[model samples]
Target: MEENTFKKGLIDGLPIGIGYFSVAFAFGIFALRCGLKGWQAVAISATNLTSAGQIAAVPIIAVQGSLVELASTQLVINMRYFLMSVVLSQKLKPETTVLDKLIIAWCNTDEIFAVCTGKDYRLDKRYCFGILIPPYLGWTLGTLAGVLAGDVLPAIITDSLSIAIYGMLIAVFVPAGENDRNMLMCIAISVALSLCFFYLPYLRELPGGFTIIICAVAASVFMAVKAPVGGDG
Candidate 1:
């Protein structure tokens, strides 16, 4: 039964796996450029499952950044996952064990979360595992290819390929945009916060993780207060 469930999850995740490959490939190339060993790229891809965190960490890795810096940076960037996990946890069945929760938490990338929880399917450990493993493998394999290939590919080709991951992000965000007014407002707030962070020297120096928390929490709270129960406006 678990095997069949895994097969179903694999079939569902096939398109997502293809998209993750391109994104993970870009990360591998960036990791290589940052002077990481090919295996290191694979390791990070396996563990991190986050593009922004990996990208942010590259500079830290290059500069031999302090542990504090690395921890703080990742904390700032990945703070959104806290909210995402909260949302996902609510959708899960009550019988989900602590071990299963551990796996789900580890595997809840932007893509995986969408695939697992966006549908009405009640998720269990087997279902989560089936959904988690393939994309993780695709990401790991893509990074491996990038590191091994080095800079052999033409700049134009690589640049074009890099956009595939961003395209996936848009696909994730766009659906939420159509159905969720709060999401649109959150996006607007994010953009505004980004602009402020870029131009304001004081804001620029603020920790990235805390900045995200502040912006997300403040915006969410404000919107929750302002918006009606039905989410009008």
Candidate 2:
């Protein structure tokens, strides 16, 4: 049963791995253009799984932002994962050890969490490892490839690709926002706040990391209070 479950996880994870490859490729180039070396870009992908957080960190690194700014930015952007980890933990067997849980937590990415939640049964270590392995390698290798090829690609082409790279963010929010009014409002609020931070006097001087933290936290807190999740109709 464990073997079968492991294979099932590998099969299910293949698509996610492929998706990460393409997205990580874009990020690789983006990081390269941001002045990160090839190894540094690959190292970031190897160590981190959250694409949005990684992308958000680029400007912070570029400006040599303070550790406080970077740490706060990461906490705000990746805070959802803390909640996600708590939820996903319920799927583990009671006998699951702390070490195993730590390993699984390291791999508890958004897509992996979704896949686990879609399953009715408990997730064992084997299945979690199986599911995580390919995507992890794909992400790291994709970044490496991107960095190595950055110098080979034409300047105009790489520049143009940067704009299209963020299409992933659009893909995620557009469909969800179309169907959910609350989510749409949240998206709008974040965007408006972001614009304010960009254009408003004094606010415009704020570090990029803090700007994201403020925008995201403000919109989230307002929405959480106004329309709590899972409230009865």
Candidate 3:
């Protein structure tokens, strides 16, 4: 039964694996361009399956941002993972051990969370491992390929490929926004705020990391206050 569940998870995670490959490939190239070695790029993807956060981190690293800047940037950008993990904990099998939770937490990407939590039944450890492993492999392999190819590829091609990351972000948010007015509003507000920070002289002078934190926290607060979901205070 556990074997069958593991197989089912692999089959369900196929598309996510494919998507991860392309995104991680871009990350590989980007990381190299940002001055990381090929091995470092691969190591990053293997350890941290976060596409957006990793991409955002590259510039900070290139600028030699302080530890506080790095930590705060990651915290604000990846804060959603905290909520995702909490939701996933509820869907885990009651018998899941601390070790299992730790492993699952380490490998919990957004795609993994989506696949694991979308199931109606409590997730078994084997099933979670099956879903987690393939994408993890894909991401690492893709990053390796990208880092190797980054130097050989023409500047034009490598530069153009950078846009793929933004495309991935749009792919995630656009469909959900179409269905949820509140989410749509939140996205719009966030984008507007981000643009303001970019264009306004004073705000533009603020550290990029802090700007992101302010924009994200402000948008979340505005949404919570203006469009609180069914729950009470």
| Cα-based lDDT for every prediction | 0.78, 0.79, 0.79
lDDT of 2: 0.79
TM-scores of all predicted structures: 0.84, 0.69, 0.71
* Number of colliding residue pairs in model 2: 0
Candidate 2, residues 88-185, lDDT tens digits: the string is 88877777899988888877887778777656677877788889887888789988878878768776765665544345446556776897899899
Off by over 4 Å in 3: 1-4, 33-35, 52-80, 90-95, 111-127, 205-213, 231-233
Question: Candidate 2, which segments miss by more than 4 Å at Cα?
Answer: 1-4, 154-233
Query: What is candidate 1's CA lDDT for residue 182?
Result: 76
Cα lDDT tens digits, model 3, 75-153, are 8667778878888999888999999888889878877786665565788887887788788888889898888777677
Structure candidate 1, residue pairs in collision? 76-209
Q: Name the best candidate (by TM-score).
A: 1
lDDT string, candidate 1, 57-80, tens digits: 987887788999899889888888
